[model samples]
Target chain A: MTANDYEIREYLPGDEESIVRCFNDVFTDGDDRFVGRDVESWRWSFTDNPAGWRVYVAVCDGRVVAQCAAQPLRMIVEGAEATFAQGVDSMTHPAHRRGLKRPGLFVNTANAFFDRYGGADRDVVHFGLPIEQAFKMGTTFLKYEVVRTQTVLGLAPVVPPDTWPAEVERLGAFDEQVRWLYDRCSGAFGASAIRDATFLEWRFSRPGATYVRLGVRDEQGILRGLAVYRRTHLVVDDVGCVCEWLVPPEEPEVAELLERGLRRLAHEDGATGLALVVPDWSPWFAWMQERGWRVHPSVYTMCSRHWVRRLTPLWLRNHWWYTLADTDLV
Target chain B: MNGRNEPQQESASAHGYALRSYESGDEAAVLETFNRVFAAIDPTFEPRDLRTWRWLFEGNPSGRRLWLAVTPEGRIVAQCAGIAQRMLIDGEPTFVSQSIDSMADPTFTQGLKRPGAFVRTCLGYWDAYSGSGPDRDAFVWGWPVETAWRIGKSQLKYEVVRTQGLLFATERTFAAGPAPGIDVAEVASFDEDVRELFDRVAPTSRCIAVRDAPQLTWRFLERPGFTYRIATARRAGRLVGLAVFRDGSFEGVPCGALCEWLIDPDVPEAGHALAHWAFACTLEAGRDELVVVLPDSRPWWMLMQSIGFRVRPTKYFPVARYFSKRHHPRWLWDHWYYTLADTDLV
Candidate 1:
């Protein structure tokens, strides 16, 4: 009930099961609309991830009450691979969600995470899609800055243009050709997730996943653009979600290919339309809106704690190349 | 707008540096020296390539005026530039220029020393160009860094108008759209309606940039690196007010930027309707928050506060050099309806 009632510390080995219960209790209430992930998926995300995870949990009377975590990732900073972390899975137990006017479980867990991972050696920057509550706590207590807000746009179901590039094709998995496309377009951004073979394979080609990979080739058959998407019913009833796209603004034809591919996939899936979250500064927002996409504002917010402010210019948030795949949600 | 202050004559003849107007061939040298000095002093500077330089210096609608200070050997050491801007004072279109991209070779001397190359070049240019008369800039203003602010204040006698506050508010704080019985429309082009809207709104605020179709086209549409959305409020088929905004992100968060807003002072509904339209557009764009920088005394500050904008901790200083007696320095903060877009940053 008071300041001395709880203590915050790193997540111990035995805390996984409690963390699962905590996640379900905080995020799910047996709601039919939302499916709560089990301990297996939690383990796969927090423990089995190749880049490793840094997690912090708050304990009161020796029971886990709140948690905050960061999933390690390799980010491209000035053309060099640098260590980064995506802040995610922040939750405070419902019973302990008190002191609405004062610091409590949320602040303590966030502070613990910041103390552990908010260092240059640990993370170049810790970024995540925070909710309203998390955003407040992060800014008020943990020195987090709102990087930008992500908006969800709904794409209307429409027939593909008759001139849909004939070069557009679907790939079973990511290949060197896809990597070349990513590398060629990567320079369009000053900072972003490192989409090398390892990261791309782990992201889009994982087992037990249903991601559709689309690509376009130039006359010589060199990969020019790529997109990875799947069907989702989160914001829109049933829509194709292009979570990641690899095309530069200079390459208008490449963007057209990716758009055509997503539309074709959505049409075949019998989905009403396509919905994707994009940062406001992304050129793709205007591109999609110009093509008659309806924008529906979502509640997602992105915040960051800079380990070294100068490592990357904060203005990278204004970049056009950032995609939803850069977040850990993908 | 040129600050109507008595011109302080300065001559580079006293110093070893020779001052001259920018010539066609001087572009490459001036640009190189600019990049070399700025890259060392400011980290945020993106090294200017030929294309960007040409666009900023040559493609500017109000042509650029650059004065350079060079050594006897013709090595460009210092440069001062006045980037011309078209603004409306009261109701008439007027030309103003921002003194920007000022730099001197650090290898020379530090601060405003007696034999000042930087001060002489900048001040000398101002002595020649600074005036409120018809031919000269209406008034000159700029947002200078702390060091430059001190130099301008102590050495050049520039008056500090107000320190700008960057404010933010969530979409929930604002109403959905225009006020009841007031109509709002998204303007696709700055046409006759925009000119009429400007005519109606110019008298409401003390100072404003005339939002005629041509000026609006050049400021918002023709400007590179940004995409702007223009909206207007109308009553009985007549334009009453207008707002300009764009979807932007702070860091990476979705946010909206209020660039310009104008309303007819006589018609109360116009201001309310235009503010509502801007807030609604930002909310509809899915921006969580909206940001604008203005002096706290402006009328919009109170109106926005009513709708839930709170001043953030950070502040930017806005200094003005008034060249016209018609525009009082003391009344600048309250009378003008300035927005973030009025500054060079937008």
Candidate 2:
């Protein structure tokens, strides 16, 4: 279809099913990377998000032809929490193919989405870990500036600390202590996703995925650190995917104890090593390297569009503490 | 045309401290501030002597430009300096500035309300040396440590270019050794052979420093305290590859790094052969692995990975400010062919 034939507008309450169909058509047709998105997961990602959602779709003959969507997030920016959004589930139907003239439906839909909800008044920053092609499009048309290239650090199974100083316990649910530890941990970063227990509950409640939570408690039985991991064989071959490993940099002993427990946890799953996603600026990136972890460039490069002057990419480049859990995919 | 103005000279005076371009006799004061500032931050920092300082700054071939914040009594309180680089961007002679030793003594900044002596001194240097003009640098760049990076990003408009990372190969699998008709040998000095080799490789690079014989000799061969191993790879008697290595330690673990590598991309085998040699030599020298830094967009990135080199993020985040619209941050990052030799740290 030509650009004139399609109508692009903000997401409506009932547009979820058609958008998911178009997304699945564009993604699951031949690409091994996607398994075809379901409407329930789409709801859980955007519609059910506590912060909010901003999505736009291209309508052709009453069926969704293309879509651009973002999952709203409440992030701990500086010291206070602010609303942000992560660009996710962007796709266009192949049946329409190229518009063959002017700006196409996909680009128009994306532009409409950004115009509707981008900037400080809406979502302060629109950020994502886009694939290379999407990143090029975002930078070329959507004014997306690169934040940094991400790397996944891998650590081989290692011997745990002989005498663990803290009690390592599996967390069946995130409690008030997780919020306290998250607040304390996020203080070290200029910007980070709000990791309150509510976020953890919604984040790890993936329908089919089992998220393993390990908490480190000090001698007083107060939670000092928390780690969340899961096995995603499709993601990186039998390696445990670490979403969050939060302990203050000053609490190295607690981090060490948490790591020891996580290593044993991952080893129990018959994994070769544990793979964690962390940004370059995170102190843990260097910490992992110092501990003999092997780091490799991940397939995704982080890009962001800053609307508020407060969170420029330059400031975020040196300060943003991000991990796999910050992303919608994880 | 898009970058900020970099005037030939910049001066600022405030609260009993004056910032100006380095004069001949100001060397001692500047050197003292540099050593003292660095030593305070790093306990193991080796104090640079006058000879080494002169060789690094004054003896540079392109030229020397250092700005120092000095008291009225001529004691230097802060300094911002750059080791000039003669680079070839898109096959044109381009003057770039590589900032080094940006330091300020706490004693000088203690009573200052805001924008202390260190920031002021660096501003003078940056204003006079960077941005767009016939005499100005195409860009000013540096690998500032984490603390300095924060200040630079916030105040000096230093955009993040790329976070520097190294290609480390811990286990060599005896692959892609010297091919037939290819020979590798250590060279005592760079000469016409190295110059011609660079001439052949220059056209293929979007951005690269002019690493001719004299430049190589100045950087790796004649540099004062470090003994660097310069190796050449010859294919059927013509120089096709050049590599330099410095035996050093990373985080107290004995390791060697391939500091510089230049070879034609068409002859990927030459690079592979040179890498194999470097890896073997590093292991032989009692180092566990060979580490290197190269832009992942360069042709050699995949080749290095194929041979065994794995990527690891470094402590450095490469930052730069560009003068021309033709040269954006990503443009420099994706095309620049640089290694550790491009930096002063190695």
Candidate 3:
């Protein structure tokens, strides 16, 4: 009808159904890359998030027309634990796409979300890998900064490791040992997601099909590195999809051992190649290239809003340790 | 007019901050201050590890001269690094220092704003390290983000050498005609052939990095984490031009990065051959876009523009300051050949 016909509000209990519809209509009902979503998936993404989820919606005549959500996450910023929010699943009804003007439904919902949860006391920092349209709107109107452009790294012909350097084993789930190793590695980074046992178990150990957990241990059986990956298909026929691979930045030997083991595992899984996503400034990026990985350009941009410059900056992509699983869409 | 300020020597201020040359044990404090300021500027800023720090500062072929601002208690509150590289300037390979890792503690900024403590620290370092003579770094230049650019241009008297933009291929297929008498092939390493090609090209090209075998090996080959593809163009079994590229992305779009291209300035045919090969290789890889960061003066920019690449809104301000009066302002932009790799941020 008109711009004034819609009202922006926080998500209530019964808003899930309308939110799911909007998500599907905006993401799936078009030529976008995302797959179709259902009510259950939506609930799992929003309600079941480990750090909790805060959502704002635009309701036009009692029907959700636009939605913006932030999933809270504990991050290690400069060796301190901080709250960072990953802005996810923003969508507007196709009927209202470009139909409304100045402070439109999309912007209204975003403004509400920012007003509610986008404060230093609340989330501290908010970031997302949004499409071009959202990126333009966020930077031009919402005061979001262009962080770093992301790219997909593909290594084809993942040659099997000739010799394993360390003890490699498949793990049932994350353990305290994993947390200890993660803590040691996480400190070297400027900004990274909290990969404690709780975060790992909650993230990878989802109910249906869980990720394949692999660990590399040293001579004294101390955990050196961990990798979470699964088999998937990309441009190549068979690809080993790496979700999250963590190794201490200072421990180059352990990192090399872990990479070799991961490559061996991928080859054993009948994968012709391996694929993963990394920020351009990732510490691991240079290593990936040194090992002959091919970096493919992606169609995604990491946009961010820094509510507190002291704790976090808009350019956190270089410090972020993100995998496909970090995204709710995965 | 933002005029240049001559270098001056200053000691530790009674105002709580002291100035000194960098010492061995000061790296940790310097890195801490660096991360604090840089992370606040761009959260994605990579925290420099000891190895990388050593590689950048300690392993510079010419040598290092780092200046820092420390507290009375000896904790480094600010750092300014001048990493040197050899570049062809006025037909001579001269040392040009890229001013990098410059940062001041946020708490100190209130008292250390422009023309204040930070500016004095920079001038102090410049006075001691930079000069026009054979013994000194000829000039100091850097690609500063907008905020730093303004400070340099407004207060520090840095000249804008060129304004660079991100250009993307507008069409899926790049339009080009085949070049006769030029052969292009992908090569595994840089050899004397490439070095000879560089010598043939460097004298005529402005502000071009001197790409000898050692520099080439260090820049592209010995790099631990990235793979670079090199395309060589030859005539009668002699190297005339070369193109260095890598597969990268911009805003999630596949980008063919034309990192560096050196062709014999005498042979215009080499540009067409190398450009054609670069476009064809990118297209063959199924890239969504081919991109390169170049100044408007480069002959290759004309070649890129001819083949559907259009300038986008993204801009990088290239600024520089000459230490010697003998330097001409126009030499910075005239006939210069640069790519993304030339920038320290990469």
- Tens digit of per-residue lDDT, candidate 3, span B1-346: 0112233445666656777777788888887777778888896676767766776777655457688788867777667777767777767756777788777677876755456666767876787667775446677888787677656755665664544456556344366545798888888888877778888877766567677676676667766456788888888888888788777765456778777778788776876777777777677777767777776655665556555565442445566777765543335555556676666543
The numbered model that scores best in lDDT is: 2
What level of docking quality does candidate 1 show?
Answer: incorrect
Per-residue lDDT for B1-346 in model 2, tens only?
A: 1232434544445467777887889888888878888898998899999988988887777667688888889888888888887778887776788888888888877888668877877777767776554456788888877678768766775665666677777764325567666788898998787778887888877888878876788888778888998888888788888899888975465788889999865677788888888887888898888888887667776577667666655666678867787666667766777778888978
Return the lDDT, model 1, position B327.
Answer: 58
* Native contacts recovered by model 2: 0.32
Q: How many backbone clashes are present in model 2?
A: 0
Candidate order by lDDT, highest to lowest? 2, 3, 1
Error of 1 at A75 (Å): 1.1
Cα RMSD of all models vs. native, in order, equals: 15.2, 9.6, 15.8
Error of 2 at B280 (Å): 2.4
The alpha-carbon RMSD over the true interface for every model, in angstroms, is 14.1, 4.3, 12.2
Clashes of 1: 22
By TM-score, the candidates rank as 2, 3, 1
Chain A of model 3, TM-score against the native?
Answer: 0.87
Best by TM-score: 2
For candidate 2, lDDT tens digit of each residue in A98-205?
853446667788788888888776788899887667865776667777677666787766444554434788888887888889878887788888888888888888
